[model samples]
Target: MNGLGYEKMEKYYLTNLNDLLLCMKKAINFINPEIEYHHQQVAYLSYKIGIQMGMLEEELKDLLIAAMLHDVGSIAFGEELEILNEGDRANAHAYAAYKLLEKFNQFAYVASIIKYHHLPWNHGSGRSFDNERVMDQSHIINLADKVVVRLNRNKPIINQVNRIKHYVSNNKGSLFADRVVDAFMEISEKESLWLYLAYYPDSINDIMEYILRDNRLTVDDVVSLTDIFARIIDFRSPFTAMHSAGVAAAAVEIARHAGFSSNECKMMKIAGNLHDLGKLKTPKEILEKNSSLSEEEYNIMKEHSFYTYMALKDVSGFEEITKWAAFHHEKMNGNGYPFHLKAEMLPIGARVMAVADIFTAITEDRPYRKGMAKNDALKVIIDKTNDGDISKYISTILIKYFDEVVSMREKAADKAIKTYKSFTEQMKISQEDVFAMVAEKSES
Candidate 1:
């Protein structure tokens, strides 16, 4: 592509960071139904405190992003999400969030902030631990997190304002930084701020626009952000650690072979990466089940694609991507679920995604069995195609280039696994440790 062509393509995929963040907020909230909009409320409170503290526009944007994503690590907590919420300390989730964010160099600072978001500010003495000054942003997020956690949405702001203030005031120098506490105090005094938090939760993004008015993301930026969530989704279970990445690679190649434009192929890869965003809602036990799913368990599994659609459908620039990603489970015969659109309704991109999902699933190792041989995998897919459960044309294309496509999928999965291992290594934590902790906590 020429310079102008590249620029146009970039613009075609260009999206607001806020749009992506909004989708992510939905995905994270889907993990635990009880904590809807928890991230957004924290982001709003953090942004308000930042403004009250006279932070620069750029600083506020960073704080907002950091606050919104601070709990991303909690995805690893599985059923322990409620336990993590009830406890008040930095734990594995904090380290996991740090590791996840720090991979993207632009988010390194934000990663640091999230790492210590739960840390208490012991007056000025808390600023330096081991001769390092904790980022003030961490303290800001800490205070915001504390406030949002205790907020009672059912009560009127007027009734709760004084009580909330007194509570925060009591922990002024112990649980929170004095300056951050002061900023919260100043902002909380505004009835509008309290009302915004209590009533206009959806307006948090609108408020963010005032701080990030000109923010725009390139296709590459969106891909990077999606890759982060992809890890969060796949990393939830050892059985599917590299699942999304493998599917993305396979789908991109399938799109290319199907004569899609370069831009379409790129978008296909993104859709593949995010196709399982809703899988975050599935409990770890269901994902790792060795036996066939019970009817109830099967029904729960079927809801993932719907959740994926709910998360991505409203993202402004992700219209095609959302359809392709969310429709992966639909069959060509109109017998498939969440939506049962038949052969005429299923787009080519969605068809390719369905094939990619099946191909990757069977070809990749799972906890219960080894990855199938190439011929065996192809046979299963071809049988599905013959049964009218998948796209026959796409299955034929995959069969013809089976070796090349499989190579692409394996290479992509290898890279994702390597990247995952790097993060776990650096954090000095492993999936085994996290699972063990959850198991131990459950037994206790």
Candidate 2:
């Protein structure tokens, strides 16, 4: 709450805009598998819509980013419940996302669009409707977000179109604006466009290609991107934010201290960030269950690593990353599920991931149990190694850098909290600013 005006606050953040976007996207994927593809559909559809509307390139790009991140606040919803269909969830993740982004100077416009991307057009009671307030980037994103989700996940093509029509007709003067509805209708009427967006929702390179083609970033961008991804993935569960990052930091430090090459350490980092991507498919009830699970629930939990493998193993450069990240469940003595890969069959990266996974799990708080003290957590990992369940090299390395790993994770988490606080402050600045800025940004 620095009393920094919204205008000034909007202009000062996002030094690494592309990296931030990429990270936010990965977070989106971690929260909802359906949303991963949905975000891309929104971005691509918004781009095509922008072209049709004769907008500038920068405007289109921003709209694309906003579209991709529209439901990002849903990450804060804690868990993905089976009964909470896309339409049934009610935490107003959009508002939460707006507040989060409002804090960071770089994302003011982006945040604005996210906050009310679902509102209806032209229903205001004789209010001043400037570009920012009624027709900016947020509007475009809002329209695209609705159109894309309906097109992809709701029902069959004909059913989806009809559903959209009904939704628009019912909410015409309430949640959605008139022009936004028009855009949604235009998209729905075009069967080919809808089909194309629905089918090719995302390729392996969807996020990578988007950033590279749009922003011209490269592999060196991984550090910042991974940091952002870890944050978002953790956001999927209040109990898990930064869990991937913490594991990555601990694993990397352990690997480096244990005489692995910088490249191997880098690989460990990637694996750590993605180790839990499969959890997206899990229902919140299971994820947050405090008591022990039923046999069926336990079996379902055992398959997360397999899901992670299925999602990433086919990417060109991600094979190793996939194997390592997915192998977190493998036991050294040939007793893990989904693939009983024993120690000799497991690569060094897999070994590191296993250690990192355990280390972070014990060190982090969970609904079922309190986090162990740092030394105690390290001792458990060490004892596991003694039992031949983990690599001694990785375990010994963990003990060596245990302090630094925990310290860095705490720092990253603290930074995210501060960022979210800043965003919340910005959202409360003025109601007029919210409506005006969100609309104009949507239009652009």
Best by lDDT: 1
Task: State residue 353's C-alpha deviation in candidate 1, in Å.
Answer: 0.9
Residue pairs of candidate 1 with colliding backbone atoms: none
For residues 1-444, could you state the per-residue lDDT of candidate 1 as single tens digits? Answer: 112243354255457777777787788777774444777788888888888899987787789888878888877544554423634224466778887878766687888888777666766665854466778888898788777777888877778878878888988887788899988887777888888887776677777666656667767777777888889888877788899999999999988888877767778888999999999988778888989999999999999999999999888778778989999999999999888989898888899999999999988878679899977897899789989999989999999999889999999999988877776575555444444433433111
Q: Please give the lDDT score at residue 411 for candidate 1.
A: 98
User: Which stretch of 10 consecutive residues in model 1 shows the poorest summed lDDT?
Assistant: 1-10
Per model, state how many residue pairs clash: 0, 33
Q: Which ten residues in a row have the lowest lDDT in candidate 2?
A: 1-10
Q: Candidate 2 overall Cα lDDT vs. reference?
A: 0.63
